[model samples]
Target: MSMSRTWPVWARTMVSRGIYSRPRTSQERLRRAVEGKTVLITGASQGIGRATASRLAAAGAQVVLTARNESNLRELEEEIRAAGGEAAAYPVDLSQPELIDEMVDKVLAKHAKVDILVNNAGHSIRRSIDLCYDRYHDFHRMTAVNYLGPVKLTLRLLPVMRAAGAGKIVNVSTFAIRTPPFPRWGGYHASKAAFDVWLRAIGPEIRADGVRICSVYMGMVDTAMTAHTPSLHRLPTLTVADAAGIVCDGAAGNRRALGPWWCAPLEAGSVFVGRPLDAVFSRLYQRSSDTDAARRAIL
Candidate 1:
């Protein structure tokens, strides 16, 4: 019998029905896997990072929270401490390159070594290359934060993790990278795809040194990041807690990549029929935008 069946009927039913989508591992096993480990999470001031910090902290991990918002980070730290969980906050603005080296130095000086690293920080832009023709800085800014920032941080931490003999790195990535190329996301897609490819390239090299890399190709989640999109407002999406749980599962398990179950078939389809899919999506988005513009003109 599958291990999932060993759970009570209600729990198994929930899993089968896709309501409670946690990994089949028991709670105690999850706790034991994370207990006493030092985990550094980026973008922890809000959204997925905040939720992840809370979950891992409750699992007995020593959580180091890093983000740009000092006040929010401190509030999260206080809440975690009140709940009897260990946590620390380090405010960082990832878009600044010079500060990254200094920040890494400061973090190493304090923690010495981090058992797990979660790269949850990112930036997104949704303007077409045509619209961005004069906005070169937008491309540079997003690329710096989404691609270069994580690279610098990971490169610095690699030595510490190698010395410790065992380490895990979890990258929160977007599912759009695998989808048929959509319009108006050149900057966002390119930056995120660069980091994803870079990590995959170094993954084999790091594995021999007792470091594991896991990339979570995430779908739409109900977070502040997606809050302003009218189309996404009413759409069903993963909760922050659910997204964090998936990240924790990657850290605790041997899986190299985790994503929504349906993502696999869609990704496979894109590989074989990408050209047609791209054409279709292009028409769909362009048509909607044109209709909206026409309606505005009529009004």
Candidate 2:
């Protein structure tokens, strides 16, 4: 069967256009997209994960927030409750892949079905490969959290999502991947990139089952993760809350695709419109890097 290229591309463009427009008043955009639904968000103790959890709960989602730090997750739960939002805290170590089965069982036992699974948990260390050396476990550790952890968790949820017959999977990806040899991000980039490819490939096969996967390729968003990067690379960054809003918008829209506008220029000439904008981003990134290095050496 011949496919309709325009629908998906147009859908993505329209979604991005809407997410950028008059911008829904927080309350308006948020509404009951969450009502009667349950959501699980990882890395929810802080940053983008926290931002997503707070909004989903406020929008009436019975949100399950998870992170490695139980105390911190509890504190966030209190904050969400104080704001009159529904939330529950779960503490789990994503580094331990074996635990996903148990975690999924626990969430199902309590919530019945997780309507939205935001694979937002991840780790990033701003160090070059040289700094990592024989500490190869560091690579596995980061990949475990930023990639495999989410992939495994997502797979575990598939049965529930398929049974429920409608669901959304949001994978947070980086604009940094546009540039290869992303400065000092060897582990984080490679890991996230691998997961991103895997998610995008399988995302379509399951769409007929009413399971939608939206991969959010974001430019830098200000958070503790970006704390040490030179301000130049981080200046245009969105606040964590702002970034989360964009992500939720995609999930709420239930659209097949959502991503940055820059991808448009880069994607227009692709042999296939849905092909990622990796090539363009890589060249632009190289130029940006040279400019940055030159600026820093003289200062």
Candidate 3:
């Protein structure tokens, strides 16, 4: 089952179900999620980013958020703070390679330590490789933000997390990297795949340090990033709030791989049935009504 569907609806919506709506007078219950801990989230101004920030705030974490737009970040910061959740906004263009380390340093210096880091900033392109000719830099730009920048930032932050004796990390990835792969998403898909590879390879070593890492393989959500894509593409897609809940909950408790998870079963089945079997199944699945409509149309 997908991460979003892995449990009963009550478990998934437990955080939002007026269960905590009564507002607590005691600091004990309100303190578990965030209370005093510091959290850093990239792309915190909108969509999954904004939703994630809101989720963390609801949980009580002091959040440090950054993105390309200063105004948007400030606005989101205000909204979160208004809710009695501590938040700070930092503006950084993640595509600009130099800024990643600088941003990491800025957060490190001010916070002394970051308890959790969520790499959620990424851009997606719906253009074909042909259009990307001489536009290989397009791939570079996406990779710089989606793969390298996040990797570099995570690397720079690792020592502090390790020394602190515990930490959590979440990488926001798209489900497009899986079956019915979008036709023009070669660069975006490949870049995200690269980051997933890098994280999984070193995951064990980090786990050895008591630091947990998870890759959130997300499906379509209503975000500005996916605005151009057809609505049908988002079939069964979670809302941004729903998506953020998965990431926040996973990061909050050290769960591995928050996901929309349409891909997991295929991969699991592929293991026993083999890649060829999976490929045939994918072709058949693509022809089925249950296949994600948007992916099929685009691909």
Candidate 4:
């Protein structure tokens, strides 16, 4: 499939360079797309969400930032305002179903319509099934934040988007959903996979209505969240700004899906060599766990 046919060459180039290059050229085109538009970003308190909010606001967009951290959100909003950018801070916990409804109401009331929606808020838990056998709450909490929250929010905002005749929905996803499942990521992967499938299934139906859906399968990003995993530090990771830039580019370009170039090849390999790949990962994980256990015993 030719990506160029689906998205403009500039859009694809912008996304690719945002990931691979570091020149930080002026994204004036993206800024024009964002200028005077209203964008709502979830998880805007810190990390990628905060970074994305800053990027869009700098481009002249009126940014609505939402997160559980009221103080941080205020700080960010003030910073943007001080820089001559339009911004508003709304704090909401996505995990609460009732809060989702209230948030949608408040956002629509204030902006009248949301031109771009960035679903960047999500929770991830890492634990083996053996360790989670007695912890069913893991599935519940992860699903609430990672799956239910975004879906409900999108559904609520759809009527407004349709009435306006154009909208962009950018889902922030992880590459793990495309690769073979990992051993200790059951809850996290399952929730992410659910949303990925749901978005793909509904994408076509909404496209004709001038609603563009872009799914971004990103790789490991260097953030406070990933800092907890020491093993991830050894691997190459994109900075928060880079990750946010890729997302901002996708939203501005209206691409179908924005992912690393290798995402398709990896997905194909997983489909054709499922069992073999699974076997390889199983052995690798077993060896790593054994080494870790031994080191812990010595300590």
Candidate 5:
């Protein structure tokens, strides 16, 4: 059985109510929102993006899958098509800005307009400041994939969405950014937070143009992205399917923000008790041991 399935009833209940509750959207609702729409999903080769693509396509959307893994994207494309869904795969590394532009152009050339854009691609790293002293590339790569890439893609597609007078942009952001900052996650947090703030800042400006934006402040999930962090494995996490469902909810629902029930409280705490929270997090960080990956990298 899965780790989530093995959890005690109370433990599961707390997770569902507090940390990361999956949003349940009816198939009929999803179909009504995205049917016949051209939706583009980044990082669609695996994990949440992959699952989201499958779900959206099943709802009658023309799904466009993009990621660095060409083989995986092609395989998913075939799988979607075999299931009687419309899907097209375009493999492009999000870290490459030029490639993103080219891919967007190609997609526009084919589909003319993308009615929904899911900015789901991301790169995550957890390393202490001391460990990163000699690894500036870590910050660079994180910003490249998590921040700049999404911004570029959004800019390219926003004009078309505005011109069409109707569109939705779903940003699959992390819940960590809304809470007190955690140690050893500076680079990752900063990069993701950049895009989060960017999207929210422009949301009002574009709302009048018939473009809507939803930011899903997602919690930990069981995916290749988190597979390397063994400590995270012990925590309650959403399955890829659960995460996908939440993304679909953001796609179909009118909510501006979707996240755990505890998110707002945590955000308030971060603002009111920033210093105390920092001290507590510092103590926790001091007690924690480095991961095997961190040790390997330092060596």
Candidate 6:
């Protein structure tokens, strides 16, 4: 059974409400901000991306959904249209750079301009470094999907957005990037950090052109992506709807960054006591066993 299903209703509700704060953007606010805009969302077939697409389409945005799952994308497109919302589905494997280019070209050809771009698709792995020595493909695949794919997609759409003189690029990043690095997540963290830093570095140059960027540092959410890791089952998690709301907040707001309330303090603490945090994590690693998913993979 999935981790979330095992939890009692009250426990799940309490954990969701207490640990994961609610998103501030309301349906009315989202409608006011996005009505009549064309928003292209990556990974729109499932999880947070799927929920975000539905919410935006309901708010009057013409949503273009893209993901590897063709059937799911088409189903979502039809569902949105049935609900009286505009939607289009373009399925492509984001890990491939050429495919990303082709997908972007087609989208532009059809819509002329994409006003908002949501980089929400991602892949996650939690194997230890020892297990990864013979599995270098792990890092390569992670970088391909988590870093290069988004970069390629963004680069293609950025020129168009800049030419239009007003655009929003919301990157759905992880809150783990804000905290001290944890064991077994080095590859995932590094790949995500690469894109986060790359975007921020170029933000100043793009701001003058009216291309605004916001990084929504998301916390762990109950989704297919996290389902395999049994270690995370008991931990607090945001629901897909909650996460979608936060992403919409990133889309409608002017803030350069948004995350859980504790992200800032954790980031600050990491900066001030990096060594101590490292030591603590190291000890935790010593006491912990490999995640169930990792163990099954090894067998």
Candidate 4 on 1-299: residue-level lDDT in tens?
22333455466446545544322325798787889999999999999999999999999999999999999999999999999999999899988879989988898898999999999998777665666666788789889888998888889988899889899998999988888898777789999989888988888888888988988887677676675555655555666788888888777885787777777888887778999988998997786542242233221
Error at 12, model 5, angstroms:
4.6
Each prediction's Cα RMSD? 6.7, 9.2, 6.9, 7.3, 2.2, 1.8
| Model 1: residue 292 alpha-carbon error in angstroms | 12
lDDT of 6 by residue, 66-171 (tens): 9999999999999999999999999999899999988988999999999999999998888888877888888898899889999999899999999999999999
lDDT of 3 by residue, 151-192 (tens): 888888889999998888888887656544444567789899
Model 2 lDDT tens row, 147-218: 888888988998789888889898888765644344556778989888888988988888888888887776
Pairs in steric clash, model 4: none
Clashing pairs in 6: none
Worst 10 residues of 6 by lDDT: 290-299
Give the TM-scores of the predictions, in the order they appear: 0.87, 0.79, 0.79, 0.88, 0.95, 0.95
TM-score of 1: 0.87
- Clash counts per candidate, in order, are 0, 0, 3, 0, 0, 0
> What does candidate 4 score on TM?
0.88
Model 5: residue 130 alpha-carbon error in angstroms: 0.9
Of 3 and 5, the candidate ahead on TM-score is: 5
Which residues of candidate 3, in runs, are more than 4 Å off? 1-31, 178-180, 231-234, 270-299
Q: Write the per-residue lDDT of candidate 1 for residues 1-299, one digit (tens) a residue.
A: 32332456565445433632444445577698889998999999999999999999998999999989999999999999999999998888888767777877877888788899999998776654555566788888888888999998898888899888899999999877877667766778889999999999999988988999998887666677765444544444566767888888888888998776766788887778888877888787776442232223221
Question: What C-alpha lDDT, on a 0 to 100 scale, does residue 42 get in candidate 2?
Answer: 91
lDDT, each prediction: 0.80, 0.73, 0.72, 0.81, 0.91, 0.90
Q: Any idea what lDDT model 5 has? A: 0.91
